[model samples]
Structure formats: structure tokens, C-alpha cells
Target: MLEEEYQPRRVAPAHLRRTEPPEAPFEFAIRTARQSDLPAIREIYNHYVANSTVTFDEDAMTLREWKQKFAYLDKLGMPFLVAESPSGQLLGYALVTPWKPKRAYRYTVENSIYLGPAASGKGLGKALLAELITASKEAGLKEMIAVVADQGAEASLALHEKFGFTEIGRMGKVGYKFDRWLGTVLLQRSLKH
Candidate 1:
């Protein structure tokens, strides 16, 4: 694994750029996250924590926590990708992390996807998920899991299903947030060769 800084190169043509404006519902690009993206990522995540059940976290993570997460991902040699518009506004991010700390669990990872409010319903989630899945496979992972907050997050469940994830387990009332207990659904997708 290289520690070199990764830069995203423009792959779309000029006409395509005009045809697909970043703010438009259909425009998005998936690229590796950079240090400069921390602010936008924090804002998007905070919005969900403050208003949605997608994440069971009751409070927004501080900058230190976010930095620690980034460092851990780097140590794992996993990719953390951000969805952005052509103008470089981050709309979402997706990544995979170790499912368990044991060395025996090295081949298994957990998948995570998060989006800005404006990025919903535009296929950005699907795009990011597909890319993350492919990247995980290439990086030699054998299985991917999605641990979803089970307040009936239908869209997330459906998206994972579309990518061949199956419900493996469910924990009732394992997370407490928003003054209520939330269930957790564990979905798994196998990529073993």
C-alpha cells in the first residue's frame, strides 16, 4: 500500500459537464476523499445525526474523532470515497471498515454509506455503494456487512439488497437515540473467490 496522496483526475468531457450540472439531481462523481473534505463531510454527518435515524449516534462527532477515523482507514489500506459535484461540493461519502478487531476477521469488513440531504434520490448512493463494493473486492476482502439502524431504513435496505446483500441478523433495541430505542439490522454480502 502506498502512502502517496491520491488525486482525482477529471474523466468526463466538457459537453458532459454542461449536460450534467453538479447541483442537478443527476450529477455526481465518486472520488477518494481528501483532507480538505473534512468540513463538508462533518456538516453532512451532523445533519443526519441531528435530524435522521439513519445513524444512531445521538451527537455529532468532533474533529478529533473524524481525524482518528481517517487515520484508522488509512492504516487499514481501505478507500474512503466522497461523492461530489463538478464544482467540488461534497454530497456524500462511503467506505468499508473492519467488521471485528480479531485477526481471524481480517477478511470481513463493514460497509457504510452517508449522503447529504440534497444528494438523496439521485442514484448517488447506489453509485457510491457499487464503487465501494468493487474496491473492497479488489482489496481482497471476502465479505461486506451493513449494520443499519432498524427504524425501518427501507431505502438503505433496498439499496443493499440490490447489490446482493442479505439480512443476516437483527438486534432489537440495541441503540438508543432521539429518546427512543432503535433496532439494528445486519446485512451481509459475500465476495469470496
Candidate 2:
């Protein structure tokens, strides 16, 4: 897969600029994630692993780990979804896993969503999260949790709030990455069947 590049389009002078707004860069379709999609999914995730504090993990996930995760979620009947373009390039992915390993927490899950660099600022995250919520409801999950980064994840916080997630708590300086102290904001949404 080629690395996504930013190509700026030439803009007309203000006098000649069109009054209409521009359309999104591309359209995408959301579907259940297949084992074959793991590579692209891994690429999208590693982009964050290498560059951002959105995820606290310092090491990039290996494909073997992704396959294991896919298998585990499949066995548990959890929702794992991917957003693909018309030409079939994966744009992003979202999934939910058991919030805790104990039996009493079976009905609760933690949600995660990641998009490629080029896919941000579009409505893809919203679309993916909406589908994830529906899928989670169908899977009999009663609650969804979002652990968002306190510093660089404002958009993530807003997206979860748009879906009715409420801020439940926060942990200050709980993580250290990139030679700096970071924190997490905990948000939760109740899922109704």
C-alpha cells in the first residue's frame, strides 16, 4: 500500500472562488471486518502508534497480534467493522471488546475507532461509530466505554458525546509517552437493545 500523500489543489483568487462548499474527498462503505483486512487495519493503527498519544501504547502491534484479536472478537461475537472505499482501500476500523475479563462485566465493552490520516475531518468516524453502536446493540452489549486521550483527542471526545457518551471520570498523568506526561478521559454510553 502506498503512503497517503497530501496534494493541495490550486485555489482561485477570492473573487473567482465558488460560493458552494467542497464535497468530501471520497466515499466509503462500512462492513464487517474480515481476516484479510487486518493488514490495512494494522497500518492505520501503527500510524497512530508511531505518531500520536491517542493510544498510550509505545509499540506498534504486529499482524500476528491483530489476527489473534480478530479471532478472539469473532469467538465472542463482538463487532469489528471496517470502512472501505469504492476501490476497496480500507479507510478506518472500529471495534469493541469486553470491558473486563470477569464474568459480571460481560455486558460491558470498550469501544475503539481509528481512521487513516487522510480520512480525518470527514464524516467517516461518525458513520463508523454509528454502525458500531448498532452492531454492539445487536450483539447484546449493554454499555460502551470510550477512553479518550486528554490532550490530542478532542475530536474523539466530541464524537463520542455526539453518540450520547457522557464523561464519567478522568485520570491525570496516568500515562507517559513521547517523553511527556499524558492523561485519559473516560466516557461511557449506555446501549439499549
Candidate 3:
């Protein structure tokens, strides 16, 4: 066959190209986290630690550290939740820790949520946050605070706000990461009616 016979005279412009519809939201169930879920949770969190400024930690957390945290939260009666697929795969996690180390701050807690890259943008974060908030309230927590990074964490900020967290304050140049100064946006929601 002649080479010229196989060539197309024109090609569709990028704008005219067809694209598939967005995928339906992935299905997952949100429930209280168990000790077995820490490995997956650590993987999700360390992704942000190593690749993004979502968490200020410059080092990856070991499984032992996660277990220590799990025990601490369990002892304190705090909420540590996970989202899982029907097949038992870990999708994401959300948890609450004491906002401060003082007894006076016992009624206030800070929340952290992390989703695996593939699990993001599919309603898992929202589901985890909703379950976390309910669990926190049931645990007698009065306030839930979210300390979201100012950079590369817009989705987190929006997710927290969607659950009624309001901007309480912002701190600039408080964290140095990836060879740049990073900041944090503080948000708080009252768990009590």
C-alpha cells in the first residue's frame, strides 16, 4: 500500500474531540477504624507528607507510630474512622485528636482526613467527615478544629467548610517545607448544637 493512501487529510481539533463522561462516584463505607487499618492509613498520609504540603511532617510515619497514635486515641475515646470498599480495601480515613494537651482543651479536638489518591474526588472524604463529626459529637466533643495547609489543600479546606467549619485564623510562614515557606488555615466547628 502507498504511504500516502493511509494518511488522513485532516484531524479533529482538541476542542472537537470526544471525551467520556465523568465516572460515577466510587462506592465505599465509612466506619470506625480498626488496628488493621493503620497500615493503609499510614500509606495515604505519607503520600501527602512526601509529595505535598498537606501535612507539615517532612518524615514518613512508621507503622509503630500509627499504632501508638491508635492506642492514644482509643484511650482518649476519640474518633478514628476509615472508609472501606465492599471488598475490604481501605479507601481513606478521618480522625480526631485532642486539640491541645491540657485538660481545659479536652472538649476541643483537631481533625485530620487523608484519602488515597485513587479514592479522592469520589465523595469518600465527605462521607468520612460526616461520620467523624457524628462520632465526635457522640463522644462528647464540643468543638472540632481543622488545620489545613494554605497550599495544595483547597479541597480539604472546602470539605471542612462544607461541614460548617469556619475560618478561625491563618498563620503565615509557620512551616518550611519543600524549600518554601508554608502556611496554615485554621477552621473550627462547634459540635454542640
Candidate 4:
């Protein structure tokens, strides 16, 4: 069921922003998406699409398509976020999109985060994910879902787990990419309070 519409946090343009480094050196400012960040986001997303099973998409997305997504998010008022280096480089991004189109799913969202190669293993994932969850909860979402694919989802899984998301189900060999069968894991965390 979930494998059918495994859309990532699909979005487009954001305003570019710069900020002073936080007291913690590892912390980067997580801000709403900027138009400038989309290319960097696409570069990071395309890396996984082409080289790993992070996504089932075999082809990279074009810039125009990315812009269209941003437009759609604008219409929905969905949140799209990006991390910026003090010097203004795009370090990573996380965003939430509707888990499904039906009105019944309005209080639920699916999240996706991608970090640049240079940004990996530096606790950036933790920071970005924490901020994303906070924003999602504040936006009135009652549930958060993470749909993680087999090969490159380990860090994502651990990050979500660290933040209190629990594994709810696993679908075996539900995808195929890079010439082999692939799997997907679903994790859930509730914000129903």
C-alpha cells in the first residue's frame, strides 16, 4: 500500500538565508527552503537515486520539475527546509509532504531528509531531523511517517529511532533498483498530544 505512493518531501523554491554560526559548532541554521537550495537538494537526492536504493526513482529530476514541486508546496503551505553553512552553502534539507491525497490523511505527513556528501556523519542528520519534527508538530500534524528503503536507509532509520520513531512494519522485496530486489521499512511516531 505505502510503496505505491512513496513520494519524498516533494517541494520547490525557498528564500536563501545566511546566519551566524550557533554556539555549538555542529549546528547549522535550518530554514525554510530557498530557490537557490533546490539545485543542491537535487544533487544530493540524485546521488541516492543513481547510486543507492534510497529511492525507487531510477532517473534524476530536472530543475523545472523541482520548481513545479515548490509551487505545489506553496499552494499547500507545506514546510520545506534547508540547512545553510555559516558561509552560505547548502548543507542539507528536510521537508514534509502529505502522506496521501485524501482529506482523512491531513493530520499525517511523510518526511525526507538528504545531506550533502560532505555533510554526512557530522550529526547534521540529527539536527535537521529534530527541527523537522518540531516544525511538523507545530504545523498540527498528528503523525509522522518515515518510509525508508533498504540499502541507504540505515542512518535515516537510526536517526528516526533516536527521535522516538518506532518501526511499525516492513515490506519485503517490494522494490527493485540497481538490478536487485529491494525492501522498504515503515516507521511511525505520534504527535497526537
Q: Which candidate leads the pack in lDDT?
A: 2
N/CA/C clash count, model 4: 5
What is candidate 4's lDDT per residue for 70-188, written digit by digit as tens? 88876777788999998888888998889999999988889998888888999898988888888887788899999998666788888889999999999989998878998999999
> Over the stretch 46-107, how does candidate 3's per-residue lDDT look in tens digits?
99899999999999999999999999999999999998988899988999999999999999
TM-score of 1: 0.85
lDDT of 3: 0.93
- Window of ten residues with lowest summed lDDT in model 4: 8-17
RMSD of 2: 9.3
> Candidate 4, which segments miss by more than 4 Å at Cα?
1-27
Task: Show model 1 residue runs off by greater than 4 Å.
Answer: 1-25
lDDT of 2: 0.95
Candidate 3 ranges with C-alpha deviation above 4 Å: 1-25
lDDT of 1: 0.87
Q: List the residue pairs that clash in candidate 3.
A: none
Please, what are the lDDT tens digits per residue for candidate 1 over residues 105-181?
99999988999988888899999999998888888999999998888489999999999999999999888887888
- Give the CA lDDT, 0 to 100, for residue 127 in model 4: 88
Worst 10 residues of 3 by lDDT: 5-14
> Looking at model 1, which ten-residue stretch has the lowest summed lDDT?
1-10
Model 4 score (lDDT): 0.85
Better of 2 and 4 by lDDT: 2
